[model samples]
Target: MNPLTRFLSELQEVSLLIWRAFISIFSYPRYYAETIKQMDLIGVGSLPIVLLTGFFTGGVLVLQVFPTLQYYSIQNEAGNSVATSLIRELGPVLSALMVSGRIGAAISAELGSMVVSQQIDAMRALGTDPIRRLVLPRIFSLVVMLPLLTVACDILGLIGGGVVASSIYNQDYHVFATSVRVGISTSDLVSGLIKPLFFGLIIGAVACHKGLSTTGGTAGVGRSTTDAVVIASIWVIIFDFFLSKALQYLLDLGQL
Candidate 1:
């Protein structure tokens, strides 16, 4: 197929996969054990990297922007700027990107391996719906976990920025905290919190779809894993922009 046709086909497949996962949840088919396992693997296992990424990102941002703010004699508002940026954008975007790289690659590789080895086919033969057994749990786990991870990341990012602002810039920590507290509004939280839900669904859908479609052999598994991460990362960024715009519009209308 041509590139355009291939792209459309892949998009349809991803939408169907997401649809199945969502519909499967309403069946009350509990995959509690699998879901919990995924939550632990994708959420708990990802904290260290997420925390580190947030800390350095916020700190570096402060380092870069502090001079500009200081030049304007409004260095005290550095916390406000940093907090707004982190909560409204960096926290969710960075956290999703990190988790996508880690979780997305792993999911694709694992399911691709299953396909190559015919384990998934065997499950089908045994009357198992892989959508329920595999995809639903992953989708649900990601939807729940990404928001929590984003919140944690935002908090750590603020702390890291606070540290840099207080020590390197000689800004008082209490003052920084107060500024951050005042700067973050309900709209910021709503905008930030909502992005992760779509991001998680998109990541899970992309990764799972890629895995289930793997061809060749081990080489194909590698390709699928790489594709899953890159595509999921791209989708996360693309959606983030639109979500930001939509959220801002709704907030401006006082609807959210």
Candidate 2:
């Protein structure tokens, strides 16, 4: 098949998988236990790394911006810049990327292994819907947990930025806090939170699709895991750009 044809075929497959998973979410014999387990794994298991990422990102932003602001004698504005950037863009984007790298790879590997082992086939043979049992819980867990993770990252990022500004830069805590208050609006917070939901969906769908499509053998599982990470990461960035524009447009409409 031509490249375009292959791409279209893959896209169709992924879309169908997402649709099936979505429908399975409301099916009888819901996998509540599995969903909760996945939530804990994806959310709680990811917390330490997420926190570290957010803290360092925030600190680095302050470090990078402080000197420039200082030169302009607007050092106090660092908090506003940091807060607005983190809350509106960096926090969600970075957090999602981190999760895509960590969780996406794991999901793909697990599912890919199951496929390679014929475990998924066996489940189907036993009249168990793998889509409902396995895929739905994962997608739902991510959809629910990603927003919460983003929020945590945002908070840690702000705190990290505040610490750097106050201690390392000798900027007053009150000034930093005031700048953040002035810079961040409800829209910024809402937009940050909103972006991660779509990101989670993308990560889950792409990862699951790659996993389910695994062939060959162990090598294929490895390839699927790697592809899942790369594709999900790329999609996160691509979707973030469009989502930002869409959210801005909606916010503008709300003002009208």
lDDT of each: 0.92, 0.92
Q: Estimate each model's TM-score.
A: 0.97, 0.97
Candidate 1 lDDT, 91-123, residue by residue in tens? 999999999999999999999999999999999
Q: Residues 1-256, candidate 2: write the lDDT tens digits.
A: 9989988998898899999998876659798899999999999999999999999899999999999999999998999899888988999999899999999999999999999999999999999999999999998899999999999998899899999998898888999999989988888888988999999999999999999999999999999999999999998999988898899898651241
Q: What lDDT does model 1 reach?
A: 0.92
**Worst window of 10 by summed lDDT in candidate 1:** 247-256
